[model samples]
Every structure is written in C-alpha cells, then in structure tokens.
Target: ETLTIKTASKTYPLYIGKGIRFQIQSFIQALEREFSSVLIITDSIVEPLYLKEIESSLTDFSNVYSYVVPAGEEAKSFSVFYDILTFALEKELDRKALVIALGGGVVGDLAGFVAATYMRGIAFIQMPTTLLAHDSSVGGKVAINHPLGKNMIGAFYQPEAVVYDIEMLSTLPEEQWRSGFAEVIKHALIWDKPFYDWLQAEIHTLADLRDEKLQFALAKGITVKAEVVAEDEKESGIRSYLNFGHTLAHAIEAGLGYGKMSHGDAVAIGMLFAIRVSEEYYGIDLELQKFRKWFRQFHYPEIPKHLDAASLLQLMKKDKKAQSGTIRMVLMKQIGEVETVKVEDELILSILEKELEEVQQ
Candidate 1:
C-alpha cells in the first residue's frame, strides 16, 4: 500500500508491504533527484540479515556504501553521530548524495539527522525494519539521545520517502512485536476509538500480530501520523498529541538507562500512567481497570523499583514538552481525545507514590 505524506517541508510517499525493500532501485528511480553516492546507515543486527538485499538493488549506483552501528538505542549518541559524519566525509559523500536508514527507529533517527546536517541537508529514505518503527519512521522528528534526556537534540527533517518492508519484521523476537505495537496502541488511544476497539477485538496473542492485522494497524497508525504531520509540521500544534504517552515514556527510558528497556515497553507503562493521571486530574472515568487488564495480558510491566518518583519527576521536567519548569503532558479526555496540560509536580509525585505503593503491595 502507498500513502502520501504531505508536510509543509515536502510531500513524500510511504510504501508499505512485504517486498518493497527489494524495490529500492525502482523507488529511487521515482524520485526527482539523482545522487552522486548512496550511503546506507544500518545497525549491526540488520547488516547480516538484509544489507545485501538493499545493496543488490542499488548495484547500478557505483558509489553505494553502508555503515553499521550498534544494534540498539545506544546507536543514537553524539559519538556515533560524529563517527558517521566522519565516515561520510571519508567516503566523499557530497551534498547531492543520498542516505538510506536501513533499520529501526535508532537507525532512522541517527541516519536522518546525519542526512539533515551533512553539508547542510541531503536526501534520505527511511527503511524501517522493526514494528515499533512504524510511528518513528513516519514522523520527521530525528535525534540522538542526551545523558540528560532521550531525543534531546533533534530536528524536524522529513525524508524523501519511507520504504517499509513488513517482511523484514519476521526476524524480530516476540518482545519486539509487543514493543512495537505500543505505538499502534497509542495511535488508537489518542486518535481513533474504532481502531482501538478493532485491536481489542482482533489481537489476543503476540502471534496475532504477524497476520494481516499488522498491516491494517500500521496503515491506520501511519495515516493518523501523516494527517497530523500534514496539518501541523514541526509540532507547533496538534502534533504534540502524538506524544500522548511520550513524556513519561522518555523519562522511563532515561531513568532505566537507554536500551535497557524497549521504547515500546516504556511507552506502555507511560500510557497507563497517563490514563491514571487523566482519571484523577479530569475527574472522569477512563476505564483504567479495563485498559490495565488489556496491557497486562500483553505483559506490559510496571514501573521499575529503582526509578524513584522524585528522580523521574526531575527527568520529566527535562522533557521537550515541559516549559518554564512546569511539566506539560498529553492527557486523555477520552479515547481518541486528548490535550496538553501543565500537570503540577505535587499531583504527579503523589500519583507516582500511590501507584508504586500499590504495585509493590
């Protein structure tokens, strides 16, 4: 399936299916610009699995090259970013060169950032391999992690196109599937109640994710993201709705240490906490227990013991959404409805303390 993402920066196509990765040459041919060289930025885990396929497709391009970073979130670091820039310089990749992000969100962010800043911006494509990447790959938000926070340094640079080969996801472990689906769930929670209900009715086991339902879910999630981006590029308005669970999710990732917990897992817990906060702050019934039951069935875990409320609160203050020392978060008014609100520190701390005590008991 093909979806056109119309952003103020550019209008691009997102090609989704089983074998689209093999059609890299055809997709590149469809682009208006030609490149002097092609640099593919991938991770170690994906190098052995699908690098040759992409390379084979680009045999017509004599200047094609590849760089392999570590397999996880650690790949999104300033050091790795610098190393990639050095590699690009050494290879003599010019401003007219193209970049291909050939892995998950980490690779996408790192490569996109490289393409964005390299010689003042070059064209790049997002070829996402993992399920979780569906959300990250669609949005142009690219960045590396900072010791202070996740995605702390980044830009709103759109890609030339997104080539999502769902077939490549077969190699992902069960946990990866669960992790990736968190974003899909988030999309449903904040934009489409029908999609949320569809998921609840259709998905019962992790294996269910491998079926046709996966494509439908991805398309729905990506479309939701595309429409939002088209309407509000650079996250100046409703774009922040996409960060529904991300405030606490980012904090969890940073608190636990990057790559220690999967982004999807952190997001799952973050969504739960957001719902809890919404219930209290809004004084409305969000059906929190039902949501908790669904999440637990998928084995989404609780907040780790070591990540204290005080420390997480401090970390959350560093979140991009936070402003003037006030922690602003996307809260649910209802499924498919949300708004950014400045949550008080005391309420957050109290909720954290109360929730942690319940979990421990």
Candidate 2:
C-alpha cells in the first residue's frame, strides 16, 4: 500500500508492503529523474544479508555503489557523514545520482543527510529494513548527532520516496522488536485511542506482532506521522506534537551515550514518564498500573538506577524543543489529545525524581 506525505516543499510517496525491494527499479523509473548512479547507504550488519538483492535490483538501471557504515546510532556521526561524502565524490556521484538509504534509522538519517548536502542536494529514496525506520524514514528530518545532544545537527530535507519492506523485519533481533513497537504504541497514544485500545487488548507479547497485525500497525503509525508532517512540515507548530516522548528520550540517549540503549527503549521510558507527569500536572485520567504492566510485559527498560534526574534535566535543556532557555515538551491532557507546553526545570526535576523513585521501587 502507499501513502502520500505532502510537505511545504514537495510531496513524496511512502510504500509499505512485503518484499517491495525487488520492485525498486520500477519505482525509481516511474519517478522519471534519470538517475545516473544509485548509491545504497547501508550498515555493516545489514550489508551481508540484503545488499546483494538490493544491488542486483538496481544494477540494470544505473551504476550501483554501496557504502556501509557501522550499525547503530554511532553511524549518525560527523566523521561517518564526511566519509560518505568522500565516497560519493570519489565515485563521481553528481546531481543526477540518487541515494538509496537501505537499512535502519541510523543508515537512513546518515545517508539522507549525506544526500541532502551532496552537490547542494540530490534525490534520495528510503528502503528501510528495520521496524524503527518506519518512523524515521517517513519524516524529512535527516540528522546527525552532536557531542552535546542527539539529532542536534541536521536538515529538513525530505526523501523522494520511502519503500519499506516488512519482510526485512523478520531477521531483526528480539531487542529490535521491542525497540520498534514503542513507536507504534506512541502513535496509538497520541492520535488514535481506538488503535491504542486495540493494541492494549490484542497485542500481549512479541509473538503477537505477526504479518497482518504488523502491517496494520506500521501503516497506521505512518499515516499518523504523514498527517502531522503534512500539517506542520518544519515543526513550527503541530509538528512538535510528534516529539511527545522524545524530549526525555533524547536526553536518555545522550546521557547514556548513543547506541548504548535502543531509541525505542528510551522512548518507552520517556512515554511512561510523560504519562505519569500528565496525570499529576494535568489531572488527566489514566490507568497507570495497567499501562505499567503492559510495558513490563513488553520488556521496556526501566529508568537506570544511576541516571541522575538533575543531570538529565540539564541535558533536556539542550534539547531542540527548548527555546530561550525554557524547555518545552509535548504533554498529553489525555489519550489522543496532546499539546506542547513549557515546563519549568523545577517541575521537570520533581517529576523525574518521582518517576525514578517509582522505577526503583
């Protein structure tokens, strides 16, 4: 199936299906761009497994090149970005060349950034292999991490198209399943209560994320993201709502060091915190224990015992959500209803301390 994401700059199609990678040549040909070269940017972990199939699919159409980066968040680095640029240059990739981001979120982000900056920008396609990339691939938010914060350096350059093949997810580790589902849950919580209820009632364990159900979840999540991005392409307003669990999530990733923890695990923890804070600060009605139980069953990580709430607050201040030294966050008044609010440091610290204490207990 296909969904169209309309942005201020341009519109692109997000294609989701089983084994769609095989049809990539036809898809690119339909774009009518006459790409001179196709650079497939993938990670080391995914290279040996899927590179041959993807490269073979494109070889008949254009000169195909592959650049493999280290797997995980570490790939979203300045050095790696520079290395990709060098590789593209050495191979003489020009404006007519197309970049194919052919792995998980890190590869997508790094490659998309490389494509966005190379030759002042070139067309790129997203062929996301992991479930987490379902969220990262759809948005035009390509970025690299800085020493100070996660996704601190980047651009709002959108992809030409996103071709997500669910078949690739079969090889993902159990941890990747847990990591990716958190975003699915996030989408449900912030936009569709019916979908949220469906998830809570139907999806009990990792085994439940099978073919039909998994497809439904991914399509719904992408639709939510597409609608939001269409409305606020640059995150000046409603787009901030997409960062519901991300403020604290980013802090946790940066605090623990990138790649040390999964992005979904951190966001799961952050979402739980956001839920608790919402109940306290807004008096929103929630079944906290029930939700907590669901999280535990799915193996979402609890807050680390040694992670200082004060330090995390300091890191949050550096988050992109912060404005003029005030930290802003997407807070829910209730399920399927949320708003961005300016949260004070003291209140944030108080809530973090409370949540951390509960985790310890």
Candidate 3:
C-alpha cells in the first residue's frame, strides 16, 4: 500500500510495499520530466547493500554519478563534506543535477549539506536506510558536525522527495535498531501520548524492530516531524520543541564521544533526565518508573565514567540551545506536548551529579 503525505510546502508520495525497486525507474522518469541529471551520494555501509539496484534503475533516465563515503557519525565531518563537493565538481555536476542521499542520517546530512552548498543548492531526494533516517532525512536540516559541536554547521533545505523502503531496514543490526529507536521514542513523547503508551507496553525490545510496530512507529514519527516542519519550517519557535531530549542528548554524544553511546541511547538517558528535572521543578507527575522499566529493558551502554557533571555542563553550554552562555532545553509540560525553556546551569549540574551518582552505584 502507498500513502501520499502532502505538506503545505511540498507534496511527496511514500510507497511502502514488498520489493518496490522495480517501480523506482518509473517514479524518477515521471519526476525527470521536469528535471535533468542526478547525483547520488551514499555511505560505504549502504553503498555495498542497495546502491547497485538504485543505479540500475536510474541509469536510463539521466547521467548519474555516485560518491560513497565512510559510514557512521564520522562522515558528518567538514573534511568529508568538502571532499563530496570536490567530487561533485570533478564530475561536472550542474545546477540541474538532483542529489540523492541514499543512506542514513549521516549520509543525508552530508549529502544534503553538499547539495545545499554546491553551486548554490540543487534538488535532492532522500533514500533512507535506517529507521532513524525516517525523521532526519525528511526534515531539511542538513549539515556537518563542527569540532566543538554536533550538527553545528547546517541548513534548512527541504528534500525534493523522500523515498523510503522499509525493506532497507532489515539488514540493520540489533544495536543499529536500538540506536535509531530513541528518535521513535522522542516522537512519541513529544507529540503522541498514545504512541508513547503503546511503545511502553507493546514494544519492549529491539527484537520488535521488524514487527508491525515499525509501520506505526515510522508513520507516526514521520507525521509528527512533517507536521512540525509544516508549522515551523525554519525551527524559529515551536519547532524547537522537537529537541525534547536533544539538548543534553547532544552533550552526552560529544562528551562521551559519538560512537561510544549511540545517538538514541544518549537521548534515552537525556529524556529520563529531562523527566526527572520536570518532576522536580514543574511538579509534572510523569510515570518516571514506567519509563525506567521500559528503558532498562534495552541494553543501553553506560555513561562514560570520565565524563563528569562539569564537563557535560561545559559541553551543553556550547550547544546551539544555549543562549548568552546559559543552558536551555526542550522540556515536557505533558506527555504529548513540550516547551523550550531556559534552565540555569547549576540545576543542570545538580541533575548530572545525581544521575551519575545513581549510575555509579
């Protein structure tokens, strides 16, 4: 079955079915009726998996060139970003070329940023592989990580189309699924209370990744993201609520080093911390213990011991959420809603100390 999600700014169709590769050529042919050449940028991990099938499908319509980079969060670097630009230029790529990011978040971020910058932006498509990409690839927020921060350098350039094939997720490892589910949980906590309740009760572990749960999770997650993007396309105000756990979550990723604690795992811990602070300060009577039970059911890596409250606070201060050297975070007023509030630095330290204390013992 196929569904077309029409945002006010863009209307693109999402086709979800068994082995949909055969239809890719016809879809692009229909799109290419108004466009020209195509540029495909993917990652090493994904290039080996589904790159050939995509190239075969696109070979007939227009001249297509592919650039494969190293996978993981590592690719979201300035060096690689520049390299992709150089390669695109070397290929004689023009403004008419469409950039297809055919991998996960890192690939989307890198490729999308390149398209946003190269020759002053070009049309692009997202062929996402990871469940995490369902959120990142759909949104136009694309960029490379700065040495001092995560996704610090980026732009709000929306994709021309997002082509998701659920079958692409099957090859992802258990840990990879765990890494991406944090965003799923974020979508639920920030916008869908019932989805959050269902996730807590129905989906308890990574083993449930391939189940019918993904359809609901992916659809709901993308819908929440699409709705938020439609309302606040530039992330000027209400859109900041999407960063519910990401303020501290980004700090954890950078402080512990990115690969040590996957993005979702760190965000999970951050979400727990946010709820703890919310209860303490706002009297938000949340079901913290239920979240604790749900979280512990997964194999979350422990926070790195060397990362002290002081260091994490320093990292958080450097984050984009910080204003005039003060920390701010997206906090939940209720399960299905959130707010971006300015939080004092001392409170952040206290929470980190308490969390670390419990973690150590």
Q: Which residue pairs collide, candidate 2?
A: none
Badly placed stretches (over 4 Å) of model 1 are none
The lDDT of each candidate is 0.91, 0.88, 0.81
Model 1, 149-254: lDDT tens digits are 6688889999999999999999998889989999999999998999999988888777787647888899999998888888999888899999988888889888
TM-score of model 3 vs. true structure:
0.92
- Arranged by TM-score with the best first, the candidates are 2, 1, 3
Q: Write the per-residue lDDT of candidate 3 for residues 91-138, one digit (tens) a residue.
A: 788888888898999999888999899899988877888878878877
**Model 2 spans with C-alpha error above 4 angstroms:** none
Please, what's the RMSD in Å of model 2?
Answer: 1.6
* Best of the two (2, 3) by lDDT: 2
What is the Cα-based TM-score of model 2?
A: 0.95
